[model samples]
Target: MYKDDGFDLVFSYTFPKCDLDGSYQAVQENSTHKICVDKEGSVLTAVDKIENKTLADAMDCNCLRANLIITSVEKPTCEVNGNYSPIQCRRGTCRCVDNNGNQVCKSSVCEVAEIDRDTLKC
Candidate 1:
């Protein structure tokens, strides 16, 4: 379904899920977000969908502004059961030291793998 609701074009959220298509992928992830080129792709802008402290503390605002994208703002949901529990460090703390001595923790409360240094961030 295409509509000229004011923008150049509009694509439905169910756009093709192709990893190789760049521009379309961005637009799919965010219908309002556009793909613009500059002397150096000079902007980075995407609303943060995750609410982890590390990202909030370390994200570079300049980069975020340059590559802006209309990220899906809908917060995620968690499937719970009678025995369901939030992901925790092995010791139940927020963080743990990995074999490499890097602090390991559940990047997201719903995640299962213990990511080290944000590498496993969902």
Candidate 2:
């Protein structure tokens, strides 16, 4: 069931367990909505809706499959020079540093490479 905040209207429906979760905000008096499907506790993708479209139409129409396909084409940003590379390497007490002063990065640890002649790098 859906309820309108400003109006005293209530909408009821019956369907499978699929649920949409996201945020909506009014920008300059215009409504902007983002809706996503929670697939097994993970958000597969946020389906973008056209202006002034109903929520049911947004999901049932062809947009859902198109959005999923586009998202699937994107690869994880794991390249050394990428923005999130440092945080990804931090799990091993390592940081991505320039290799030969170039943009390429190699793992470099902050502490000494040896501790009592045993490697203590995380």
Which candidate has the top score in lDDT? 1
List the candidates' TM-scores in order: 0.15, 0.18
Find the candidate with the highest TM-score and give its number: 2
Give stretches of model 2 more than 4 Å off: 1-34, 48-56, 61-122
Q: For residues 42-90, write the lDDT of model 2, one tens digit per residue.
A: 3333333455345323232123223333455532223211112222222
10 residues in a row with least lDDT, candidate 1: 75-84
- Candidate 1 segments exceeding 4 Å error: 1-50, 68-122
In candidate 1, which residue pairs get closer than 3 Å at backbone N, Cα or C atoms, i.e. clash? 43-66, 43-67, 44-64, 44-65, 44-66, 44-67, 44-68, 45-67, 45-68, 45-69
TM-score, cand. 1 vs. native? 0.15
Q: How far is each candidate from the true structure, as Cα RMSD in Å? A: 15.6, 15.8
- Candidate 1 accuracy as lDDT: 0.31
